[model samples]
Target chain A: MKEIAEKVVAGDVRTVARLIRDIDDGMPHVRDALKRLFPHTGRAYVIGITGAPGVGKSTLVDQMISHLRKNGKTVGVLAVDPTSPFSGGAILGDRVRMQRHSMDEGVFIRSLATRGHFGGLTQSTRSAIDVLDAMGKDYILVETVGVGQDEVDVVRSAHTTLIIVIPGMGDDIQAIKAGILEVGDIFVINKADRDGTDKTMSDLRLMIDMDQKKYKDGKWKPPILKTQAVFDQGVKELMDTIEEHRLYNFKTHGDLPFRKRKDRVGQELAEMVKARLIEEVIGGLVESGAFDMVVEEIVSGKLDPYTACERIVIPVLGKRP
Target chain B: MVQKRRLRVMVAKPGLDGHDRGARIIARAFRDAGFEVVYTGLHQTPEQIVDAAIQEDVDLIGLSSLAGAHRYLFPRVVEILRERKAEDIMVCGGGIVPEADIPVMKKAGLKEIFTPGTTLDSIVAWVNANVKPR
Candidate 1:
């Protein structure tokens, strides 16, 4: 474990990749490696790109990687695709668009399957991000599975979140209705050569204007940009804007972004606590058949769900005042 | 709780093969068999495929070439994997390779070759029997 962690910190690609796979597989010993690696993280600036299917997220990410590389930044990318509900399998095709960077030493791209996870990312995504970060990547770009409104968890982990939309999806009302709207640090209208580009831009502009009052305290205002990702158009401006946002974060949060980092770590800690409770407490109940007895009682109408809940929790908590 | 590890496979169409129906079908078959399939679309060089396979930590590489470049491209993937110390990633090929070249390919470190008329079931079965996630 020590060897693996040290190799990952040394940026050994094989060790990093294998450790990430172990993380995804939910191997327990990986926690030791992660503990060793934790101190080495927080160096990589994380960027998240999310949008609907067919919005060219991968293409834009590819362009961003090239631009970052030219600026001498080593990058790591995690592209997520959904697993099939029925087969528990996934065809992770996002890397197909970014394969050009595969042979580049400075660029490491990994594709993750959203393995029964619903939050636009897999269960291991946070750990995988730490792996890449500890591997000394300057930037870590996480592209979530083509998302709908509610898969906004990417915002929790990323320093900057980019919400991408293409033309002709819908009007300004669609933007307003989406839960994703509030999460964006930048909104990109990709496929701009398409017909409704102007309309989409205006719609986004109006939406941003309506939300402008929230930024009155000198908070960063999300900017809208038009891009033709396939043609590599307007991507340079996107990179510059991302760098500007990174700088803004550094200036406001004093290099460490203490508040944002605290939020992320707090969320992670809560999740770990929940998982441990499920594994130890609930798993013990199920193994000892107490859980089944409660379920049977509920099914027979002998106990209501709320009463059964108290019956389980009161034992664990020893009768609250 | 220990979760069962799923086999990850890379379905790549190496060389300039624009015909990818075979590759896509195999990729879907792998998915149906509960394998995580990373499909490297259309034209990819051996180097790109090897690099991706390593980074993904995939257990197998399914190379499809209908463009008759399999003789060079298929074995080249295995060669590069060996050179990169990733020969643990098994290489298998499908599509228009003649029966005469099968032995040579096997000798060149391709674990198996599936010509036309191969059923998706047999491929999945072979993978199930052979590939173990590292």
Candidate 2:
């Protein structure tokens, strides 16, 4: 395990993947492996690509990977999808959408399904990010299923969120739901060749202007780039915009040592809490058959599921007051 | 560190498929059988599933595909694992896979296929017997 961690620190994808698997499997070595790899992370930039379905998010991600690779950067993509019910399975079609970049060694792509979990994010999305980050990818792209609100939550994990909208879908209300009108660090109107794109861009511009007026805090406006992803048009400009955002953040934040320190501390705290809660659930309670007893109680009509949950949680987590 | 327990299994969907009751039931069963599960959100791709599998490093990959595209999708995943040279990973599938296609799927390297109405106990037992902790 120490040898694997050492190799991963040197940016080995294989070791990184294996270590991630061990982490996911809740192996004893995982925590130590992470402790060793911690110093090697924080260099990779995370970019989130999300939007409503039919907005060409996957194709755009493929193009972005291609563009990044040309500049000699390693790219990692996490493609998120919805789970199927009738068949406990996935169509796994996102790879087909990214066929052009399939052979690229510099590009590492992974698909995550929203199977039984409800949140906008996949259960293993964080672990996948860790593996990609540890592998030393220059850019990590997270492509979500693009189902409105959930997309927003997933994008929040990224350093920069790129909300892609097609012209026809960019209505006043949709602009809010797609979270394009707010959460984006950058806006992209993909499939610009389609009709009604100019109108969509105009409406988006109006919304942005309204937002700027509403805030008036002198914050930099997120740049909106128009592109037709099918033809690979306007990709260079989009990449340039992303770089500008990075440079701006770097220059400003590098001068504010405390802000960076605070952010790092907050991130670590959140990660620690997450790891602890997961350990408690999977290790502390679930393994002891306590959870199953509650399930049994609910099944036998001794208690309702909600009450059972309250009973279990209140004792373990303690009272609020 | 917590003592290692049962293998954590993440049964995931890879694309725009919305059928999840089956996946949820499987997750519940796994929970009952004492395996940790991390269910992804929906419409995930092959890459996302593989990435999750690689990261979570479960003892097995259980995919449920009702979509007709599994023929194309599953192979690509197996190929990626092979390319990563992590082909020792166990792969399994369920959901509307016809018995006729099972042989072909198994030949293509999927170890098992669970048709509709497979008992939770059987699935759990198979996994326990076949996939041990590393």
Candidate 3:
């Protein structure tokens, strides 16, 4: 285990993948692995790519990765695809399209399934990002589950969020949910090869212009850029816009960088607490048959679940106060 | 909430065979068994299979094909994985592979092959038992 941790800290690809699996599988010793990895994390520039499905978000990310690699940056990609909300299974085909970077030792890509866990984020997402950050990546791209709307969690988790919109969204352009509109640090009009590209850009510009509260602080205006990700066009300008946004962020919040990390720390702790409560408190009780008596009582019809819960509430957890 | 350490399996269809019924069933089976399954859509090349595995970091790659090209294409995935030193990933296949050719494919580094009539239970159990922990 120590050897694995050492290798992961040394940026060994195999060990990094294995440890991430450990975290994904909820292995018992994952805590120890994460402990060893923690000190090495929180360094990578985390970027979140989000949009409605088929906005060419995946292709754009694939292009962005190649560009980043050419500029001598080591990259890690996390592609989040929504699993069957019922079955917890997903068709994570994003990597199939990203085969160009398969042999590149500098890039580590992993697909994450929402797994019946939601909140715009999954618990495993943080652990996965930490593993990548600890592995010495220059940048980490988190492609959100593209399920749209509730995915604003990316804004919380990523330092920069890129929202991709294709030209000719028509009514769909107005259909952009309020949550999606507010999270973009940068907007992209993908499939610029298609007609109505200018109309799409103008519509987005007008919408951004109307969001008065977004510019009240006058910090930054989300730039709308164009791209034909399949052909790899306009990606260089997209990267330039991202770099400019990164600089803008640092210039604005550099003095209180710790504040950002502190926010992340708070989020991580909340997630850990939630997970622990579910596993240790709830799962332990169920496994220990503590719920059996409650079940029996309910089954006998003498006790309603609410009544039984009230009866056992104090025993299960010390008085609320 | 805490999620189970579900095994992740990638079921990919390589070559031009578009008979996705088998792949879809297996993907659903793996999911129902509480394992995460990622199924690559049809017409994937051997390179795409290997790349998907590397990127997704899956514990198992189940290549589903009815195209009679398993003999030629299945081994190519294993070979590329070996070349990249990703032998830790378990490679398996299903869909119309002949029983007689199973050993030959295994010899070339295909870990297991499940043809028609194989139960999803058996495949799930095999994975639980044989997946490399790394």
lDDT over C-alpha atoms for residue A242 of model 1: 93
True contacts kept of 3: 0.50
> Would you list the C-alpha lDDT of every candidate in the order shown?
0.86, 0.70, 0.79
True contacts kept of each: 0.78, 0.10, 0.50
Reference-based TM-score, model 3:
0.83
DockQ scores of all models, one per candidate:
0.65, 0.11, 0.45
Candidate 2: Cα lDDT at A299: 89
TM-score of chain B of 1: 0.98
- Tens-digit per-residue lDDT, A1-321, candidate 3: 677778987887767877777666667787888788777876788898988888988889999999999999999998887777766666676775676676688888887776654342456777788889888998999997445433566445788888888878877776664567777889899999899999999999999989757677657999899999999999999999999988887887775552256766797578677666666655655667877878897999978998776665555577752
What's the i-RMS of each model?
Answer: 2.2, 8.6, 3.2
Candidate 3, position B58, lDDT: 79
lDDT of 1 by residue, A1-321 (tens): 999999999899999989988887768899899999988888898898988778899999999998999999999999988789899989999998899999999989999887753231434787899899999999999998545422467544788999888989885438534667777899999999999988888888888788778999889999999999888899999999998998888887886643246776687677666655555556678768888999999999999999988877777777764
TM-score of predicted structure 2, chain A: 0.83
Q: Which stretches of candidate 1 lie above 4 Å from their native place?
A: A117-123, A146-150, A171-176, A257-260, A279-321
Candidate 2, what DockQ? 0.11
Best by DockQ: 1
Which run of 10 residues does model 1 chain A get worst, by summed lDDT? A115-124
C-alpha displacement of A177 in model 3, angstroms?
Answer: 3.6
**TM-scores for all predictions:** 0.92, 0.68, 0.83
